[model samples]
Target chain A: MEALVASAVAVMTAVGVYLILRRQTFPVVLGMAMLSYAVNVFLFATGRLVVNMPPVLSDTATGYTDPLPQALVLTAIVISFAMTAVVVLLALGSFIASGNDGIDLGEDRE
Target chain B: MNHWIIAPVVLPALLAPLLVLLARNDLRAQRMLSGAGTVGFAVLAAVLLVQASAGGIGVYRLGDWPAPFGIVLVADRLATLMLALTAALALAVLVHVISTGWDARGRHFHALYQFQLMGLAGAFLTGDAFNLFVFFEVLLIASYGLMIHGGGRARLRAGVQYVVMNLAGSVLFLFALGTIYAVTGTLNMADLALKAAAVPAAEAGLLRVGGVLLLMVFAIKAALVPLQFWLPATYASAPGPVAALFAILTKVGVYAILRMVTLVFGAGSPAGDIAGALLLPAAGVTLMLGMIGVLGARDLGRMAAFAVIGSVGTLMLGVAIFTPAATGAALFYLIHSTLVAGAMFLVADLVRGQRGGLLLAPGPRMANHGMLAALFFVVAIGVAGMPPLPGFLGKLLILDAARSAPTAWAIWAAILVGSLLAVAGLARAGAAIFWATNDDASPVPSQPLALAGVAGLLVALAALTVAAGPVSGWLNATAEALYAPAPYIAAVLGGGAP
Candidate 1:
């Protein structure tokens, strides 16, 4: 199971990086979303793989997965969404203002 | 749980909507209300400092839940110090903005400014890693609005780039935080410190990999060299108070790195020498590169931005070296840099107003007033780490700590070269603007507003530097607490020996 999860992570990271390198704003935005999800899932797995146990506290079970990771990942997910929304707006705003939405928004520093 | 830990987080957020409603009719009423709210925040910050001191680690669980299960707002000495500084800077900006009459009550500016303060306070006081991200976004949102205020073309262009760059950084930041979560299974910084340190040897490398990724993202924000390109341009073009405000934002990134490094990856932890070595070189390079930039820049705004960069380099040098004195230097320099950079930005705004900014094409009213030019000259010298200033004292501590190291000579050389070059550059700018024969003075309007604020800040800086003994004593305590992470970890982890 650990091997399977790790493999999935590797694939996701590769795809995300490739998309991030693309020369268009929309693809880059999509890449960020994919990358954020893969990251959150991967981080949740770092506490070590656990099965049939959720992070929620219950009376019967001795313990579930680590709750700290859960709390953090949840917040990361929410903030990432906010970030995604902002980036999309910026890309749209750039397009409306400049009539071009290339991938290199401000990569060159002068 | 003392509410002090969390009130600053919620107050502006809750009060902003209220302000939008209350001040809709009366502009004077809005200014009064906003000023009162800011004062209230500063007072609450004081209470939180006291609570943090007594409780040792004030963790107020949001929604009445226990640690690692609910949202947490933690305030230790470190967090309290950051909170206190943030509050103080905001208050100072408030004074400057009001006295200068930079803006009237039109255009929802006061509300957004209030929200920005709240976000900064939240970022400082929040305990959980994810909450930190939330606060960062909160701050960024407010910042976007603040940057484009008054609708100047240059401001609009820079604001667009600034937002996009930070948005990208935010994405990477979340990804890094997520990576940490995947490995540690805990987001609470305290819990992660303990758990991450205890990971099995087989898995430690991967965990360290994640940690380094997170560190890199912060390094970018902290404007560590090789990742510090966006800073000067964006900061140079920003509005006066907004640029001053950004001085603290970079430190927030640096503070997060210092805290994360000391608490999450310090000695006796799974994170090893490789991590320390990785960061140490970046510090030296950042210092050198910043000096080079300062040497080459022609414009006043851009030059001040490089000075801010140079200050950050000094800070990174202290933290990366990882000694008691070095860490203390880092902490002290952090405070000094934020204040000095802030004051310099204010100076830039004033100088630019008279000369009409840094375009080579001369404005009709090209620096008719000598007062502001002289004032900025002294400030530029002070910020260059020249004699009898806070920056000089801060650099001395860094050099003292680095004296015995192999890289000591290089850092010393960089510090000297950087300061001297900046002095030459800014003095040239001063000579051209202030001392040159006035062929076409045009009688520039008096820039009394920013000049007064800069003058006050410079005097305060002089006092701090001159009285370095007692100030250094207080700073030494801050330094000791920062480098030695055992106590901090012990407090949050509930009595286990770190």
Candidate 2:
């Protein structure tokens, strides 16, 4: 399970990095979204990936999984969602104003 | 148990939403509320500063939970001093924006400004690592709104770059946090400090990787050399008051570096030593590159932006030394640089308004050229670390502290030469703006309130100079507190072994 999670994160990060290097704004935004997903997964996996276990204690069970990583991941997911929304609007605004999807500035064109 | 430690964060947080809902369309009311709130904040910060300097470390835990399990806000001398500086800077920038009517240019300016203040205060006061990241996003998103507040092509372009770069840095922050948490099973700074030294030898590699990644995140935020490509464009393009407020943003990076390094990885730790060794050379290069950027700048705003980057480099140089005296000097320099950089940005706006542009070429004579020229000269001298100002004293302290370090000579040469180059670059810009003859253009009228804001900041700089003796003593004590994490650790973890 850990191996699977690790490989998934690696693949997502690789693709995200590749897309982020693209010149188009939409792709870069997509890239960031992908990267954030990778990060969230990585954070989630920090609790050692226990299966068939509750995240709470009820005084009946011998043990339970660490719930902190789950909480952290949830917070990260919400923040990254907000980040993506903001970036999308910004990129869209920039595209509409300049009539181009390229991220380069006017001076850089010259 | 003190509630005041949380007020700096809570007041702004509550006021921001109220401004958005209650005073959305009422600009006058919005300004009044924000101004009042900021003044209140400043007063609170001053009180906190007094309390902290008197050797009180206030730790407020949310829901009255124990330290390692709950969100906490720690206000020692260092945090309160930073809080005070942030409040003071926010007040000045608020006045400037109100005076210049810069807030009218964008939607939700008051709300965003208040939120930005909340984020800064929260970041400075929060004792939990994850909460710091949350506050970072709060400040960052607000800054993105403010950066393009005026809505121009240049701002849009720069704003996109700035947002994307910081987003990447945020991801890095998450990864670092994950690594640290996985290795140590805790995120509370004091708890981490206790656990950091006990990390098993087998996990040392992971800890070092996490430490380095965290440093890189801060390095990006501080705009150190390779990671600084976005700063010049962003700062130069942002609205005047927004740029001015951002003067403290980079210091947030430096503040985090100092806090984390001193608490979690103090001197004598292998990770601490490695981070310091890495930071010194990078700081030197950042200083050199920033000076070159200053010299090569084509406009006053861009020059000011580069000078800010250079100042960060200088602050980091002192930080790299990792001595109490050096850290104290860095703290002093940190305060001075934030003021001078903010003043420079405001001055850039004044100059830009007068000449109708910030370009380096000779322009028409300003209406009040003499007064503006004097302001420029004094601010320039301060920024370049010349005499009769706090900047000079801060630099002397840093240089004096560095004399005992192994790279003392290199640090000395870089700072001295950097100051000289800054002077030359600023002088050239000053001469072109104020001295050169151009008869075709009419003088631009100055805004009284805006001028007052700039003058107010200059007065604060002067106050910093006059109060240097007591201020340095406080900072020295703060530095001592930072190096001796026993008090901090005990306060956070209920008097456990440090």
Candidate 3:
């Protein structure tokens, strides 16, 4: 399970980096969404992967998974969602105004 | 009461729901929200100041769970001071937003602004590493909306770049956090501080890698050079109040550096050892490059943005040197920079609005009233680190501290050169804006209320500078506590973990 998640993270990171390096906007946004998910999982994993155990105490379970990572990831997930929304808004807004979502407006002299 | 513990967060959170409910029905509801937000700022500022004055740093736990487990808020003197600064600036900008009567402050605008404040306040207050990222996103989202509020082509274009850069940093930040967590199994800052200090020498290099990566993420946001290109473009083109709000965001990034360095990654830790060495050169080079940008920049707003980059470099100069006096100077500079940067951006907005375009645009009619131009000049002087201003005094502290280092002579030279370049840049821009009577003059007197507010802000900043002696003493004590580690460690850990 850890290996699978690691491989997924690797692929996602590669794709995201490639997209980020591009000049256009939409691909970058797509890349960001992918990267954020990868990051969330990666961060969650660092609390050290656990299975069949949740952070919340159930009295039935002998011990719970680390509560710290659970808290961290949950907050990261929400914030990433917010970040992605803002990026999309920016992309659409840019597309509407200048008709290009390229990296920069080529020096912003105006 | 504990009720006050959540007022900063609660007020803003409550507004979002109320705003949704009022989406279609009442414009008055939106206006009321702006007012409510100002009140929230006032209350939050008062709370932070009173707490700081008492030399008490309060921690609050949700569901009453203690720290290193439940989410924790540690309002140390530094945190409270920062929170107060954020609140005061937000309140001033909020008032400017309401009284100025721009077309953008509609149903969505006020709520977003409120959320942005909540994010900032949260970032200022939260003591844990994980929650800091959460707050960053909240502010970033609201910032995107605020930046493109008017639907201008250029603003949208600039805003996209801004979003992309911050997103990149956000990704890096999380990855860094994961690596740190993987190594230590700790996300709480206080916990990390204790654990990070105790990491064995064999894994020291591995740990430092994660630590430096974390600093890189923050440096990008603070607009340290090479990473800073996105800022001037985005900030210069952003709407007035939005730019004003952003003034605090980068400082938050700087605050993260301070928070991390002095507590979580101090000396004897691998991260601290490596980061200290690297930050020094970065500080010097960043200052040089930033000065060049300021000199070459054409637009008033963008020049101000570059100047901001230089100011960051100055603050880092002291910190990178890493003595108590040096770090204290850095803290002073951080506080001073936030105010001066906010004021500079507000002046840009005032200039742009009056002239109906960029300040340096050819044959542009300067519509700013004479008194307004003088006000802008005063703020510009503050940013330039002119005497009797907090900016100058902050730099004085930094130079005084940095002068004692082995690298003292070089640091001293870099600071002096940076200050000169900053003054020259602002002076050049000021001459073009105020002295060079435009071919077409359109000096618009600001609305009375807005003028009054700007005047009040200027006066307050000046007062702060004039009262610098006592404030410096207060800041020194705060800086002492920040450096000593024992008080902070004892408070959070109950001193049990050795």
Candidate 4:
């Protein structure tokens, strides 16, 4: 389970970086989404992999997984979701305004 | 559990939505509410400053939960000082926006402005690392709205770049937090401090990577070299008052570095030496390159943008030395630079308004050209660190404090040469805009209140200069407190020293 999660994160991160390096705004937005997904998974695993265990202190529970990372992961997901929406809207705004979605705008506009 | 520690964050959070809902279409109502709210916010900041100055770290835990468990907002001297600075700058920018009617150019300017202040205050006041990230996002989102408020193609394009870059930085921040939380098993800053100090040598490398990653995140915010490519475009394209308010944004980065260094990685921590060792050289190079950019800039906005980067470089150099006296000097300079950079941006906007653009080329003699010229002169002198302004005194203090560092000569040389380049840049711009004017073009009338807004900032700078003695004394105490973090740790963690 740990290997599966870690490898998934690594592959997603690599693909995200590649897309982020592209010239257009759409790929960059997609890249950001991919990166956020990878980070969400990575943040979730920060508490270590524990399965079938209660996150809270229960009398009958044999053990517990760290609940804090679950909480942190939720916050990360919401924030990244909001940020991705913002970036996508921004990309769309720029694309409509300028008729181009190239990431680089070259030099300062006078 | 003093409640006032949370007021800075709460006041703006509540007021922002009210402005949007109640005063949506009424500019006068929005202005009155925002102006009064900002004045009230400044008063709250002053109260907090006084409270912090009384030498107790006020920690406000959320939901009445205990330390290292629930999130906390801790107001120390450094945080309050930043709060006070933000309030002052916000008040000035608000006045400028109102007088010049920049807010009407876009929707919900008042709401966005309030949220920006909330985020800044929260970021300064939060003691939990993850909470800091949340505040950072809040501020960044507000800034994105404000950035392209008076939307244009260029601005939207710049805003896109800015948003994308910050999203990447946010990702880096999460990665760093994940690594640190994995190692220390805690995200509370005070707990991280204790855990960081006791991390085994085998895991020290991981901790160090986390520290460096965090540094890079802050560095991106600070516009430190190599990562500074986004600033010129973003700041230059932002609306004037928004740019002025953004003067505090970079300082937010510097403030985080100070907190991270002194509180979390101080003295015997595994990542203790990372900031000082890496920040110094980067700051030096940043200073030189920034000033060179200033010299090459053809427009006032970009010039001011580069000047801001240069100021941050100088401020960080003082911080990178890692001594109490140096930190004190840096704090003094931090206040000075934030005010002056804000004034410079406002002045740039005024020049753009009167001369029909911000391009540093000959134009017709503007209305009140003499006064505008004089205002430009004062701001230029301040930016170039000339005598009689706070910038000169701040730089002097930084240089004096840095004399004991092993790389004192390099520090001195970078600052001196950077000042020279800044002077040349400002002088060139001033001459082109104010001196070499054409008589063929009609004079544009300058707005009195807008000019007064710029002067208000200068007056604040003058106040900083006049109160330098008392301010430096206070900052010295603040620095001393930072270097000795036991009281802070004890205050946050609820009993005896860690």
Number of the predicted model whose DockQ against the real structure is largest = 4
Candidate 1: Cα lDDT at B260: 80
Instruction: Encode model 1's per-residue lDDT on A35-109: one tens digit a residue.
Output: 777777776676677888867778888668866666567776887787778767766765665566674436432
The full ranking of all candidates by DockQ, starting with the best, is: 4, 3, 2, 1
In candidate 3, position B75 carries an lDDT of: 73
Residue B146, model 2, lDDT: 91
Better of 2 and 3 by TM-score: 2
Writing each residue's lDDT as its tens digit, candidate 3 over B1-498 gives: 144555677788778667767653666667777677667676776876787579765767666666677667777788888878887787777767777765344447777777888888788888778788778777777787787777678877887888888889989998988888887777788889888888877776767878888889888878776677788888888887678778888888788888888877777675556667778878887887777778878888888778788888888888887678887778887878887787777777777777776656444555445776788778878887887778888989998987778888878888889878887887788777777664756756556576654665677678778888888888888878878877676666562221
lDDT per residue (tens digit) for residues B1-498 in model 1: 566677887778877787788786666776787788888888888887777555476667677666665566768777887787777677667766665566562377778888898888888877678778788888888888777666554555555666656766776776677666666767777778778888888777877777777787788778888778778877876777778878888888887887787768776667575546777778777877776676677676777788778778878877778777887776777777787888888877765666666532334444436666666766776777776667777888888988876788777877777677777766666665566544666556674554656766776677777777876776677667766666665555453221
C-alpha positional error of residue B356 in candidate 2 after TM-score superposition, expressed in Å: 2.0
Clashes of each: 11, 0, 3, 0
lDDT of 4 by residue, B23-111 (tens): 99999999999999999899999999999999879888888788899898998999999999999999989989999889999899999
- Any runs in candidate 4 off by more than 4 Å, and if so which? B441-443, B495-498
Give candidate 2 misplaced runs (Cα > 4 Å): A106-110, B270-272, B441-443, B495-498
DockQ (C-alpha based) per candidate is 0.32, 0.66, 0.73, 0.81
Q: What is the Cα-based lDDT of residue B130 in candidate 4?
A: 96
* Model 1 DockQ, alpha carbons vs. true complex: 0.32
* TM-score of each model, in listed order: 0.88, 0.98, 0.93, 0.98
For each candidate in the order shown, give its overall lDDT on alpha carbons: 0.73, 0.89, 0.77, 0.91
DockQ score of the complex predicted as candidate 4: 0.81
Candidate 4 chain A: worst-modelled 10 consecutive residues by lDDT: A101-110
How accurate locally is residue B62 in candidate 2, as Cα lDDT from 0 to 100? 83
